[model samples]
Target: MPAKKAANQPRKSMKIKKGDTVKVIAGTDKGAQGKVISVLREQQRVIVEGVNRVKKHTKVVDAGGRSGKSGGIITTEAPIHVSNVMLVEGDGVTRVGFRRDEVTKRRSDGSTYTAHRSVRVSRSTGEEI
Candidate 1:
C-alpha cells in the first residue's frame, strides 16, 4: 500500500521559492541581497547567488590513466538557513502574505462562472511579490 495524499497538506520547508530576491537578515552575509538559486528542503537551507561562499580543497583525478593533478582551493556556494533570509519588498523587507482575488463573471454566449485565485504579496508594500 502507498501513502495517500490528503486534501490539505502542510509544507515542511520555507515558503521562499527560486528566482525570488532575498536579503540576508542574520549572519556574516547580513544585508546582502541576491536571487535564490536553489532550496534544500531537508536541510532547511537555501543557496543564493554570490552568497555563503566557502573554499574547497580537491585533487584532480584521472579516470582512464591520464594523470592525477595537485590539489587547489575552489570557491563554492554554501547553504544558509532559510530563517536568516527575508523577502524584500518595494519599500522594505516584509513577510509573504496570501490574498484571494474574486473573479468577475464574463458571459460570452450565456454562461456564468466564478473563479477565485490566491496570490502572494508583500506585507510591507502590499504589492504582489
Candidate 2:
C-alpha cells in the first residue's frame, strides 16, 4: 500500500514572468530552454515553448448528429513547476536579482523625489534584464 502524503504544502511565489526565456533545471525536460508562454501563479507552474510537449487526442463536436467529425492527436506544451526552471540571462542561465533604479521623479505635490523602481537584474553579470 502507498503511504499517505502530507495534506497541505505551502505555495511558493514564482519570480519568473511571461516571455522570459528559461531553462528547465529539473524533471525529464532538464536543460531544455524556451520562452515562457504563461505563468500559473496559483499553481506555481510555467508553460514554456518547445518544452514538456504532450500529445492530446482532441475531437471536434459537430452539430450534424456527430456524423462528420475530425479528431487527431495534437502536440502541445504542458505546464512545468516553476522550481524546475531557471531564468536564462545572456548566453547562460542566471538567478534573478532585484535592484532599485537611481532615477528621480517629480511628485504630484510639486516636489521631487527619488523614484526607486525595482528592476530585475542578472546575478551573474549584474546587468538589467
Candidate with maximal TM-score: 2
Error of 2 at 107 (Å): 4.5
- Best-fitting candidate, scored by lDDT: 2
Error of 1 at 10 (Å): 4.4
Clashes of each: 0, 0
Candidate 2 lDDT by residue in tens digits, 31-125: 99999999998778999999999999997766476477766799999999998999988678999888888888998999997767988888888
Name the weakest run of 10 consecutive residues (lDDT summed) in model 1. Answer: 61-70
Clashes of 2: 0
Over the full model, what C-alpha lDDT does candidate 1 score relative to the true structure? Answer: 0.85
TM-scores of all candidate predictions against the true structure: 0.72, 0.76
- Cα lDDT listed for each candidate: 0.85, 0.89
